[model samples]
Target: MIFSAGDGKESEPSTPLPPPYSGHNHVGDIEFHEILAGTDNFDESLVIGRGGFGKVYKGCINHGENLVVSAIKRLDPESSQGASEFWSEVQMLSRLRHCNIVSLIGYCTHEQEKILVYEYMPNGTLSDHLHKQGTPLSWFRRLNICIGAGLGLRYLHNDVGIDSGVIHRDFKSSNILLNESWESKISDFGLSKTCPTNQLSTHVNTLVKGTFGYLDPNYFRTGKLTRKSDVYAFGVVLLEVLCGKPALEELVDGEWRNLATWAQDSIKEGNLKNIIDSDIMGEISPKCLRKFVKMTERCLHDNTEQRPTMDAVVVTLKSVLALQEKLSMQAAGSRTIFGRMVDLLPFPTNGENSGRVEHNTLAPSKHGDGIVVAVKMLTSKTRQAYDKRQTKHIAELAHPNINIGGIFECRDSKHKYFNQLLFPNRGNFAEPLSWGTRLMIMIGVARGLTYLHLNKVHCDIRPSNILLDEEFNAKLEGITKTVTKETHISTWVRETMYYMAPEYFWNGDLSMKSDIYSFGVVLLESMTGRKAWVYGHIEKASLVDWASTVKSRIIYLKEIMDPRLNHNYPLQGAFECFDLVLRCIANESKDRPSSKEVLQTLERIYALNK
Candidate 1:
């Protein structure tokens, strides 16, 4: 029995079901009236969700001998979704059947009322669980959810028997629903379309309509949709899960930034640790993290052909989950010091200070107990000298920028070592630094140098000697030489050549101004994201020379600025900082500013920007 499409009341139809919905079960008009209590009168207490289509109500009904709960989506008569969308959803859900796809229990069309019923998902939408400040999901749970969504897409694109494969045009976190047991299922097919199966054509040219942040840039630009379009949206969801942030965020300065753009840049610049969610820190394995990020990067590639298929994505996720499981099991059996188990993962190669630094974990103890620290092993050749210098320096000097790794003495061995607290969520200066962070680091380094120059001189100054704490505060490390009436030129020239001043490189001239020259080189590297000496590109090509070539023309600053920043820095501060860097790197030792002057300039620039 069917109801007429005109009036708001229900009436039995004498005709057969239409050909478009021929084989599907059409609920009787009288049965729907009883389930909904009456015509167009829904209880506000039962309203579960509201969308562009209309309001969704939770209701229980009798299916055969069992009581079944269902989500009934009732479309408003004045909504943009009219008869076309109602019929489209009915056809789509009825035809597609998979474990990962939301199940369609039944539908109702009584007079002017259009409603669709789905199996009630007790846990609500994936968006609610992820961004609503609820209980945070574990890394493994989030990975499983993404795998389930990928499987659903694989079935729609490849497993379905229809000549035209299904493409979920609006695939975002909100469209993913979670069940009572936390199983994920894809829902909402209002904007989905079937790709033409013709052998000659590769895509379907159509009008583009989707959520703004998740829309594929290519599809939005060309109005040509492909299966990869859905892949692009799924990439955004992957980032959301990893970072626990929205697809777009408005900054305090009233700028709306895209998550995908920021994430891609961060990853490219080896700054993934900076953008990852803090909750998942130290929980994710390094190998798994790298693989997961690489997969998401591939999915977000601008070239459609470069993006991997949904089947490939599912396989990669399964592998990542397996690695995470193995690491968890290993951690369970790992050795614990104090009360925390130590992760056996080695430190990244780029952040090592000498060949001795290794990542180690230490458990928290009482209120003033120590935290996880990285152990640095000293070689026999340098052990005596390092011990003498560190013992004197650690006892005499105490500053926020100085690296004071506490000494650890082992009873069984004849060697004593130093351990520094580790920053698990930050990479070394080899990775890119935000403009603000660069300024803060430069100031900290200058202050540390100022303290050293007042008593002793720092013979070695480079990016590798500067360590950043978890808060991105710079700490100065390595050896310092005593300044006496007699200058030691040979010892200073033996250090890293790239950062040494020209006067020291030409002849052995060791002074405080020489340290200022090295600081200038580091400042330039921080700003341009380039090394002091660029090899292979040109013979004996120095970063100072490159900058000086373009320094005269201020318009060329755009080419030299760190690309990872994406031009999201303060322009006035950048120009001011560049001018300071130039003064510090001047050829003549007398031409450069003193360490104190450099510190004051950086402080002023930071203040003006703030």
Candidate 2:
């Protein structure tokens, strides 16, 4: 039979599927021999699904004399975060040996590629069996899958091999794999982290990570991650199993809502008929459905602290299955954070990933290049600010010998997955710049600044608004540096605090001479390998003050050179740079050299090194 949509014509699937397995019927052989052997034999031809980090394939691995078929995941090298996630999964799964949890037999990272071997689940993923076009599972089996997955989660949260205090940041149906015996295993630990038990708010301040539909709204707003975040995600997954709907979708009202909200609204109105999956209609006992919904409601409670623990959730879900007891399932409709409605709402964008296959927009380059580039994508607010600044301020910019390259705004591209790129020759900070490169950085930055200051436009400078390419070349990356009218008193004061000339800090005014003062700070940072603000004994902090005091000591320069660059820095070059820095940071901004003179001096330094 075929399905039809609005057009009334038989609608074909966008993609076709490979034929089912014909060679091997043995579950163990399919897992161990053909798959886990970790060969090219098991490639995309056997792939079952693709996700943010990698693709999942079906194969078999050799288990001694016996062959076991299994599922293997391959991580793409170009994936923005593939390497870190691959190792994280290895660390979490390799040590864990449990019945309910999926077992990690072996892994391989060859030629900048990663592959994970796991025991094959003939029954496929829980999401597929629950929502896919296949034989509908009995309510008993569905509940069994839930309990089994919950057990696996409980073990991860506590019992596993160790109390590493693991937080499975991403938990959903697609991640739950099922075996022939119908037992479930929770997989995917890419976002998982091991933290200290003493930590109070499981919510750590981190960059926003996780899928759109499953992400904890609270965690997204505050950047604070907690175990309750997982509970919220699990609640969504439970609703998916119960209702058989995608997490988020555009409804008739034009508002995007997830399964949790839909289920909640239905439960409140006593409209289970419309909410429950048609396949399991009339089969699930009223008592079981009520209990299960209550379990989901507890998991979805807005107050993460008030939500049942994974341990409690497991017990409640199990009791629902066995005792068929009814639960009150009362959840306050209006939760705090009403103001965050705008944030919780999903916005349609060109490129969005939900731990699934990328849209395949960017094509890979055929030629090999030594250089790699990294670009950070900013929000619309940041972009708009940059645009306004670009037209008003053609800021004068120059600094030490750092080289700066052209500034370009990034747009969504097929090659650009997350609208960010951190490439290797495009810039290098992990390794120390060589002495020759250091001199080049100084001269180049000075030249860029010389052009800016000489341009007749007033410009304010800050170090963070600077850029360095792979060759240690520095350039000004700010939208504006020049000023015509009296700059805002507050804005000038803030800028001065970071790279202020002594006079500018005391009284908010900036000039070309003041630029020299900030340049001195940059020079010191490059020489000493210390950040502008290092946490000191108790009170004092400031890179310039620290460097000045250290420069007076006999052994100071040696102490400050980056260890990665080795100890063989030329003394004459060092003294020249130090003298240049001291001149720039002189008591008065007027005494500082013009960027033109600074460039001349750095050019001499660069020549000397060569």
Name the top lDDT candidate.
Answer: 1
Off by over 4 Å in 1: 1-19, 22-30, 38-41, 196-201, 337-610
lDDT accuracy of residue 116 in candidate 1:
77
Please report, in order, the local distance difference test score of every candidate based on alpha carbons: 0.69, 0.60
- Candidate 2 wrong stretches, greater than 4 Å: 1-44, 64-66, 161-163, 197-201, 250-256, 324-610
Error of 1 at 39 (Å): 12
The sequence of per-residue lDDT tens digits that candidate 1 reaches over residues 427-452 is 54434456777788889999988887
lDDT tens per residue, model 2, 1-610: 0111223222222231222212212222123333434545656578877765668787666655756676787777665445556666666776566678787756665555567778888888888876667557765677788888888877776664333566777788888888889898988886786654444355555555677678877776666667778888888988887777767766676988767776788667534434666555534544455567877888888777777778888887888676432221111111111111212222222222222111111111111122222222223333344344443332222233222222222222322210021112335444455667666666766777777665542344554555554444555553333453344321212223445566554344667787788877777666665555444542234666656667777556676665655865677877888888888988677788888888888888777777
